[model samples]
Target: MKRKKTLNMMSEEDFLFTFQHGDYKFVFEYDTPDEFREYLSELKDTVKELEAEKSYKRVQQIFKKEEQIEGEIKKGERPANKENFTFYDLETKFIVGKKKLEKVSASTYKAYEATFTKLKDFFKYERIENLNIEDFERFRDYLSTQVVNKTVNNHMAYVKMFVKWGNDRKLYPENNVQGVENLADSSPEIPHVNYTDKEIRNILEFEEFEQCYKDTFLIATRTGMRVNEICNIKNDDIKQDEETNIYYFDIKKSKTNAGVRQVPIHKDILERVLEIDFPLFPEKTDNASQKAILRQLYRVVKQGEGKFFHTFRGTFMNRCLKNYPRDLPIIQEIVGHEKEDKIKLSVDTYAKGYQLSLKKEILDSVSYY
Candidate 1:
């Protein structure tokens, strides 16, 4: 019998060569000139076998991984599954994990949570794969049905914030929802600035809410503070004993960081607050029954006002312009506003009577009479 060629054949010279067919590419190496020839012969046969096995794509993928590892090793980088990455998937992960949401106020997070919930409901299936501008448009339409133009604008703002936040984490492309604009009249309708002190007194003087009403109204009136801000106020926040004495409440939360303040406690309000027995809205024993009772009480107590809670808030700002420093910037500071310039401009536009009063004060002080 003829001697068989060794399968692990070696020779004196070593050489390297590359082989390619269509998109598939590979390297062929041999120890010597004879083995280099042998490798080319074997490579051709291997390609024919791969073609017969219908694995052209598999062969290309193997070559690609090899190339990827080579480049990664040179760069001192670990290989990752690039195939698994996408904009939406990465964004969801970032929003749920890396976005320091705990630092955000509970109320602010509540609003974000509401907007996020709506997104979840709208994009229940394959949210990552299927989200588009039209999806946002659909969300806009849905929100329009639920709220007014101003509120719809707010939802849009929140959504934009969410998208930008997602972008910061390399979650999605920046300005992905760039075309969505704010409402035409973005300076929200200033909440019908007509609710007054007398109206507030009249509502609170009614028997139903009278028990806690005076306490509630006094806090709102004296400080130009928000309703929820007052509601969240703990009994420990009260610090004075006399009706005219000055004290301070550590304002823990508000619309912005500027809202955090040590508000002076008008003692009249402090004394009234000290008298309340429990939470203003105590839990009723029955479920639906309690809500119905409160609704009736709301109607009986706040007849003319469209919203009971907001009526107090409007009253606070209105009183700020009326009795307190009507200087727009001063008013903004008293109310813990971040942007004094905008407040001054808006207050100036709707504050003709106030401006006139200031002019009168100046004229009177000049001793021109």
Candidate 2:
């Protein structure tokens, strides 16, 4: 009797096995040498059975079995059919597991929840595995029609983040949407118009302007703090310098490391802030407060598309640069901006920062009156 070859095999590092059955070929991966040997032995036994039966149908069955085993070993803990895993499932895991683990603030959590809601609406119960780069690009196009370019970028950023998170866990093949670029506005960019000194005075003196909004605007204009930073200010954040006795905002919580610095409260709003018992705009959400401020601002001044609450920060920076052109580092520190110049970088590395009194002087120079 002539000897028959059971199976043709090639093994690499005892981790990968390649098998050829006539013209059909298959590959399998195993975690361990023992696993590879065990799988190979089982496959050999099946081949023997099929060959002895001399059934062509049984020979085709061998290839099917080989593919099934290959997929099973490669997937490991992942489900056999990832098609059932929806985008919503991955989102829920991220919200419940990763977000909770990070202990993000209420406002940040709300923002993430809002973004996830938009993603869910766009994806619409689609399998996460089925999502590809084209789908994300289409979602970006959909967002562009509905919101501004800036907002579309925000939504797309969240989508990329969520998709990458799912991919890390082997929920999908890969982060296929990672290559999707942010949408660029087709319209010409409108330069941000800083609120003029006269406009600043008009807004503050506006009869209909709410006290809280005024307070928030005042802080942003004087200290060059962002809208969210102004809104999140707490009573404890206000501190008095021991030597200078000048009151300043000790901003420990900020969006960036550069933002986490002390800024002097200009004397203009000092008494008003003290009288209000600090945190002048306490418990107000940044978004709602910003919209309310804009509505009141438009009532007093002519509505300019570029003029908004954030313009105050830019206006403040403009004043700082105009008044203290030589003190660029001081102005950068006051505005929580990362030092860009070599001189500023050296100063930042060696010196802690300019004194509170110096910072107060710089802020006092930023007067609209």
Candidate 3:
């Protein structure tokens, strides 16, 4: 038997051995000959176990476990002893810490909360330390069954974040989730469907649609705001520009800095909004309001398979581009899109954006009738 082969001898006491078994390769380091012999004995035992099990996954787990133990020993930290600690326990602590710290926005925090809820449901009572790459693969399989590939990727991203958080805190071994990868989002990429003027009219005039849904859809189409931004509008958010006396939506709090802008209300919806006093939709959760809008939209529009509440935004942009193709900067400002082109970037750096009156003109021009 090839008993001991030293690949690199850094010193008389230090030894680094590169060992390869079939398709698997591992590097082991020891401070002394005695330690090297001890590790060799452990390696032999692992080989015997692998031979008995003949499972490639078990082989990975065993080697990864050894590496984790070695890593902890090198760092002068005790190896993770989380036999009683569970995925639920770590997730609870992580979520509570996130909430207490207020590190993320409410919407983002809600997404994290939802992801962890699914993780808890799937991984119930599973030990955090025992979770290896295979377990995460299993979790991904479970997520695929529950949601579309796109949503599964989102959940997997959150899971990866959670595992990384645990590793950073030394709560678990880093190798536990080392090989997990998100499933490919093979779902067909549906092109953004811009609602035509006729389709828009049908949705707004449908007698079955609730008044709030109509208002929400109208606001979205007119202002080009995201569903969350539209739902978050308040009475105070409606402001009149002092210089031009142009009334606009003062979107102060937004998901992005570019989203925080004065979106001039279109002339078509202005009078109706003023009649109802600013907040067009009734006070309700953003998610609920968004769902209501979608439900109403689907009921009225026959060609709404890929279309959503956000499609109204696409329609707004399409109309703007159709009318003012040269004034891309103004359109981008109105829709709260970041100026990415060199010309737009230069304009953003030097200019405070188009005047509210100019924005109003552009928005008023976007007519469905």
RMSD of each: 26.1, 24.8, 26.9
Superior candidate under lDDT, 1 versus 3: 3
lDDT of 3 by residue, 77-177 (tens): 33443545666666555765575554456667788888888877978887777777888899889889888989998888888888888778877666566
Model 3 lDDT, residue 311, Cα: 83
Compared with the true structure, what per-residue lDDT tens digits does model 1 show for residues 1-369?
Answer: 122244335343324587687678878666557887888788889889878667777888878965755554333222242223333343344344433444454455567767767766666544332457676777787878787778888878987777765556443344455577665654434334445545556655666555555565556656667655666676666554254344556677765666765565543455665666644545422233234434644754544435555455455556555544445454554556654556645654465222323322321221101
Task: Give Cα distance to truth, residue 118, candidate 1, Å.
Answer: 3.2
Candidate ordering by lDDT (highest first)? 3, 2, 1
RMSD of 3: 26.9
Q: What is the TM-score of each candidate against the true structure?
A: 0.53, 0.68, 0.68
Clashes of 1: 1
User: Which of 1 and 3 is ahead in TM-score?
Assistant: 3
Q: What pairs collide in candidate 1?
A: 13-31
TM-score, model 1 to reference:
0.53
